[model samples]
Target: MASFLDIIKRHLALSIWAFSIIAGILLSQTSIDFRAGVSRLAMNSLYLPFTSFSRTYHLLRDRRVENLRLKEELTTSKLRVEALKEAQRENERLRRLIGFSEKIEYSNLLAEVIGRGTPRMPGSLVVGAGSDRGVIVGLPVIDENGLVGKVIAVNDRSCVIQPLNDPNFKISAIDARSRINGIVSSNSRGKIIMENVPADADIRRGDAVLSSGLGGLFPEGLLIGRVGRVSVPQSGLFMTVEIDPAALLDRLEEVFILFVGIAGEGESGVEPPEAQ
Candidate 1:
């Protein structure tokens, strides 16, 4: 699996956006049906191996989780206490998922994660839901842990997500404890950070960060991550804030896409490209 991942990282780093533009331009005169056929073939060729790997990884993960649950059932009193704590945490997560669903003005649709993109686009994820299921570009995608990414490209059968960790991604965020606001984005090296924060702000390690919904692009109060490190720059007025994402993004097997969008912003996302 390590070698496989290395191969993908080394050889499959080209962005889909680049592919779309090039295909669209070169095949501008092609019939729509013809282009669609080519797009499907290309998408399958590019992503099928990754999909199989993702499923295998998740199967092992599920087995580990099941083993932990079984072991808890046979444990001593102290271990039983740990089991209870774990149950409570799970209950809280369920309650949070319910609350999140209700708070949204639009409906949610669950979709399976099929693949990942890397190298030039490390944060790209491909999901097995698309236009046929009413998914479009700019829809917010989340899992129980919170915001994961947004739908960026879609066809009849699948779509690609650009997660929060992507270098091209940014959102308005606030410290839940301090109520101080900043823009959350990835730095040059792909680490998530909350920028434009005041040097003297009341942020601390472990402070919960959430989407502020100030820009109207993303909904409010979704957990982005927890604050990690706080440091002041030598010659800058604002401090640097590192953040840890709320979700195990690399392990995501499913996600929920909200049907809401800023009308024209999504526009059915970019359609799969035509072939020459």
Candidate 2:
């Protein structure tokens, strides 16, 4: 019984002493070169696996961050491309307007579209220029395509334009092909109706319509619209004609108001000035 326990306690101190002696003999080498080689080999063996794992983890983290950064840059580039396209379209529109304005014979006031009229009445717009820009009632407003409307009301900074689709708007126009005269007016149905055309008139579809200078409001030769459908009822003496206005009113964003110059003559066939 004292046999097994006493034997282990006696051997434990001896085991520790033997280990220390062997370690001291290895550390106290005869040559410094031998010791340096052993230390290098031990350190490499101990740290190689840990160092490799650390490098792999950092590489993965950096790759993830770079992917996120690339995605954000791609999104921003798409937005910038869209913005550039919109700007190009606007520039083209302005260029066309400038060329159109140069050929007209009246003093012009350029106005930016501020607001649109109620959607229920499509074709009308509010402009930023009004009396302050010399815009007055009955002034003809036109875009690059053709006549858009006339000024119906004016304030200091803004005015309301009555589009050609309005019932109160009328322009004397002539068929460019046949030279037949008629009045282009809008009905309550939002259709432009050409009146005063004779039943036997030779007007046809696709005939260009131009302002006839019959009214003192619109300038002569300004494009008005094109004749669409021409009908002659059995008992009717006048032809029923439909016209499509030349202006793209629904997409209008800018307009030029025509001011009657002091030296500009009144529209052809207008009455002379009355005595004051």
Candidate 3:
């Protein structure tokens, strides 16, 4: 009897708790205010996490954009700095050329070197002045030290010059001390070759060479270079002479274009320069 009473009491308690929970659920579903409050609570819980995720994503995207913009700005700044440095170097070179030009006696136009010729045709350069500037073909170009090249081709605003070291270049030259005439030409190695020098020629090492003005192309008495070596090859009729150019061909930045035509030929009335 005692065990049966205990069992009944436990079952009654459990049934009452179940009935209470069912009653509360039914009441919550029937009330519109209660249902709205539950919906809002659920939405609020999801909103916080979603809003945080969205904010974080946008912040990362903005940072990435900012970094890219900074990188581009840095690159542009670097390029500007390099350009300024290059301009400074060019200005210094032009100033030196201008001072050298003032000392020249002949009427000449200062020209800047714009470009060099292709590898197939080495020892040639293009200048900034051409026919429009009274520049003409066959005009001799010179630097501070001595002769550089001759104008070969011309355009409205630019001209091509064949340097003294060009293989196709040849000029009549003479020994300043011995007064011996020889044909100075350039070899494939861009080295000066003075040929047709007689075996008994008075030419010797360290002798200065000058233009002879024999072909009427180049004027007389322009310094070419000093003879470096002289050799009498076996079975050769003429001696092979090597010369070092007076001008710095490898570092030419500016050159003076000699106007060799008659006076009143152009507006500047440039005349052929006499040998100094």
- Index of the highest-lDDT prediction: 3
Q: How do all the candidates rank in terms of lDDT, highest first?
A: 3, 1, 2
Comparison by lDDT, 2 against 3, better one? 3
Per-structure clash totals for the candidates: 0, 0, 0
What's the lDDT for candidate 3? 0.84
Q: Say which prediction, candidate 1 or candidate 2, comes out ahead on lDDT.
A: 1
> Model 1, 43-120: lDDT tens per residue?
699878788888899999999999998787767767878999999986786676677667655567767889898455
TM-score of each: 0.58, 0.74, 0.63
Model 3 regions more than 4 Å off: 1-60, 114-126, 153-155, 176-180, 188-190, 200-208, 213-216, 235-237, 248-253, 260-276
Residue 209 of model 3, lDDT score: 96
What's model 2's TM-score?
0.74
Q: Write the per-residue lDDT of candidate 2 for residues 35-106, one digit (tens) a residue.
A: 888778876998677777888999999999999999999999999999999999989988887887798676
> Which pairs clash in model 3?
none
Q: TM-score winner among the candidates?
A: 2
Error of 3 at 238 (Å): 2.8
lDDT of 2: 0.81
CA lDDT, candidate 3, residue 203: 83
Identify the superior model by TM-score, candidate 2 or candidate 3: 2
What lDDT score is found at residue 6 in candidate 2?
85
